[model samples]
Target: MLSGAALSRFRKNLMGWFAEYQRDLPWRRTRDPYRVWLSEIMLQQTRVAAAIPYYERFLERFPGVEALARAPQEEVLRLWAGLGYYSRARNLAEAAQEIVAKHNGVFPSEPADALALPGIGAYTAAAILSIVYQKKLAVLDGNVARVIARLYAVRGDLRANGTWQKLQATAGHLLAGRSPGDWNQAMMELGATLCTPRSPQCLLCPVSEFCEARKQGLTDLIPVKRSKRSTVELTLASLVLLDPRGQTLLLAPPAPARKSAAANDVHTLVSRMWHFPSVAVLQGQAAEALRKFAEESLFRGRGFRLEFFALKKVRHAVTFRAITIFPFRARVAKLPRVSASKAFPLADLSTVAVSNLTRKVARAALALN
Candidate 1:
């Protein structure tokens, strides 16, 4: 904890550094709560450089809370297709509708009302309220938490409930200066650019003098890492069927449960989105499992024989799962009349809302053709 004089000097140094060095982000140009809210949601689990383009494109489409509230959920998901974390887009649209119905489309100024919205938790509520409403609340996101952990030399599982509450308290105490918004961003910026988890640039840090972890030469060890989940390797066999018209068959959400013995192997890699017919396979059973799956679910009563050729494999990782996808392509004489699937032109896939995993399978299949 910083003393009165020390805290004052620390705030002055941090704010000065921020004023001179803060990157010009698109969200910083406006105080609109909707825009700030979009940036906050997009930046969660996404890099700044990656989120900027999505943020601009989303704003261009929706424009405001009313527009987003009025838009279909599918359209919202379509705009957020490549951003990943589809739930964020869903919640953004839902929250917008809530604001329209319950709050007349104006973002809530009260912290409680903001927190009541979907996907708006403590950190998000604090961030938006402080930045847009000047509510004087402290934002304790991952970046801010890491920065606080180093500043106070806090060591332990930072995710532990007790430790997290203490850190939140400390963050609130350190909230100084007239601009809580700028102050919060400065702390997060310092953590992102200088106080990184690996090889932190202590030499360039403006608040290094106040960082107890740096003073003790334990900056690297402070903010102890959480235990990592063991990676589970999974293999999925996907079939991409194309008609003579060059239209590809894509399955809709909630794919039928695999009746194969490998049913338990199925994972939630792809959510409720358009995707190729895919099934998890045990080692050395890719061909057999997919054949049975196609026969049972995709090709049943469709009057088309399933003759498919293997395409290049695509490897992807989602959180703890390392997935290797076996893509197979087949040309059909005509489109199948399956209720669970739809045919889309292979040339233009951007019109549909799909996951990155689906796109990977499409790209791998396309690369060979």
Candidate 2:
């Protein structure tokens, strides 16, 4: 708990640091609720540096809420190609349309209305209202959570009820009587820059004097995390089917059985893009896995004397599982008589939407060809 005098001094020092040191991000220049909402969505599960180019390009293409609302979801996903997390792109567009329908293309000023939108959650609603509308609501993103946790020496599982409640109280208490835009940005900026999760620069921190963790030498241990999910190993085998014209065969995903967080990850696997048959396989059965996948994917049914090439492995991480992917390439001498929908020429890959994971897989396999 911060005393009245201590909180005032802390906020003063933090905002001073932010005023001089905050990065001039493109989104920071505008108070447009649309842009703020877009940035917040993109920044979720994505790094700031990577999100910048996407943000700028998306804004150029979509321009505003009305523009985004008018654009097709395919174009939006194409513009969002290689960014992964395709649901965010889809949901962002849905939310824009909702805003247009509900608020005449303007973002809602009320937190409840914003939260009612398709992808806008509590944190995002708070951020949009606070940063753009200057509503005095505390933003409790991962960055702000870390800053608050360390400043007050919060410990235990951050997800635990008591710890989470304490952090919320600390954030609200610290946010009292401050400009929501400046204060929220200051807390986040401090966390992103100085008060980082690992090896925080205590001496350089603007509010180091007020940080309980720094004074107690517990900076590294202050924001203790709950036990991590155990890392599981998964081996995935994909059969790459190619035509005589050097076009790669791609297919749309089958409908998933149900919707869950894990289902969302699978959505990222082949959302609106061309992809080969991908499936998890048991260990040490790479050959059998490829054969089964090839059979199921019409690679064998095409009757084109396919020759297989064992390309290099592509590895990717998702939550607890580290997937080691083995891609096998097969070529058909003659093209199939029937035309396909989503297949594209390998050379013209740039013209089509491709997931970042697919790009990574292609980089490893295409080099072999």
Which lDDT tens digits does candidate 2 get at residues 1-369?
777787788888888888999999999999998999999899888889999999999999989999999987768878898787787888998889998998988899998898898888878887889998889888888888888888778777776878776777778788846578788888888889888878998889998888788889889897885678788776777766677778776665434343534532434445545566666677788768677656655645655355678788888776566777788877766444332346667655666667766676667667886
Scored against the true structure, residue 303 in model 1 reaches a CA lDDT of 62
RMSD of each: 2.8, 2.5
As a whole number from 0 to 100, the lDDT of residue 183 in candidate 1 is 89
The whole-model C-alpha lDDT of candidate 2 against the native structure comes to 0.77
Could you estimate the TM-score for every candidate?
Answer: 0.95, 0.91
Q: After superposition, how far is residue 50 of candidate 1 from its true place, in Å?
A: 0.8
Give the Cα error of residue 332 in candidate 2, in Å: 1.4
Evaluated at residue 90, the lDDT of candidate 2 is 82
The global C-alpha lDDT for each of the candidates, from Candidate 1 onward, is 0.86, 0.77
